[model samples]
Target: MAFAWKAAGITYNRYLAIAARVVRRSLKEGPRLQAERRGEMDLRFAKWQNGKQGENKSLGEANASAMAEQAKAE
Candidate 1:
């Protein structure tokens, strides 16, 4: 029964229109959507760099203070 249906091309053009519409929609949205996504990633990276710099500065200060305390004790 399944082989008979396959021989008749039962599903050959079943979803052709739907597949075309999907392709068109993706072509329409691809560039603009990708640009927006890239912009979002750039903004996230900027924020991360800012936070990393702040943390590094804080750590440096803490280390310097600890070193100063050690020197005073010695």
Candidate 2:
């Protein structure tokens, strides 16, 4: 059987994100705040070139800009 998210043309990551958001929204005040904190993406990444690592960058910032660029292109 085909998955509903696949039928909707969203990637698995996107589907999970949507489901998580729904679950978080269903929580009461205090627990909802904690659950939202858990959803935060505090990730760091670095580029590698010629066997060397570059300075670390915020993954959230990277993804935001990438999505922005893609929107502009589209």
Candidate 3:
């Protein structure tokens, strides 16, 4: 989550605020804003998963490792 925030330069809460703004503006502009928001979110996730430029393993792999450890512990 911290990595996600750093990758986006905005925390989840800040993203929510931006989302609210986008929604309000979208009411006047229509559904195009939704696509824009989705694109931006995808870019942020990609950046986080890639680690500066996707040079590292994906977030899925990270989460999987964590889950595997937890299962082993149990």
Candidate 4:
């Protein structure tokens, strides 16, 4: 199966990561634990820059750190 987000350059893993974070923050104690488990998906990916592939990191850390860098850039 495919999702519209994928066509917008978003991966399924990233979509799930974002959803899991939201669910985790909104759920109650018992359900929160289960949602946190859903958030535990660790994934690796690569990026090309100037035709060279960059090293990989966990999906969450990669996106968070990238946002942090962009915030610093602005």
Tens-digit lDDT string for candidate 2 (1-74): 89999999999999999999999999999999999999987889999999999999999999999999999999
Q: Give the alpha carbon lDDT tens digit for every residue of 1-74 in model 3.
A: 45665698887888876777766666745576665665453112244444556545556676789999999999
Residue 7 of model 4 has an lDDT of: 77
After superposition, the stretches of candidate 3 with alpha carbons farther than 4 Å from their true spots are 1-6, 29-74
Best by TM-score: 2
| lDDT tens readout by residue for model 1, 1-74 | 56544576666454554454455556556775664454331111122454563322344556678999999999
User: Per-candidate TM vs. native?
Assistant: 0.24, 0.79, 0.30, 0.41
- After superposing candidate 1 on the true structure, give the runs of residues whose Cα lies further than 4 Å from its correct spot: 1-57
List RMSD in Å for every model shown: 20.9, 2.1, 9.5, 6.4
| Between candidates 1 and 2, the TM-score winner | 2
Which candidate leads in lDDT? 2
Q: Cα RMSD for candidate 3?
A: 9.5
lDDT of 1: 0.53
In angstroms, give how far residue 58 of model 3 lies from its true place: 42
lDDT of 1 at 3: 58
**Candidate 2, residue 5: how far the Cα is off, in Å:** 0.7
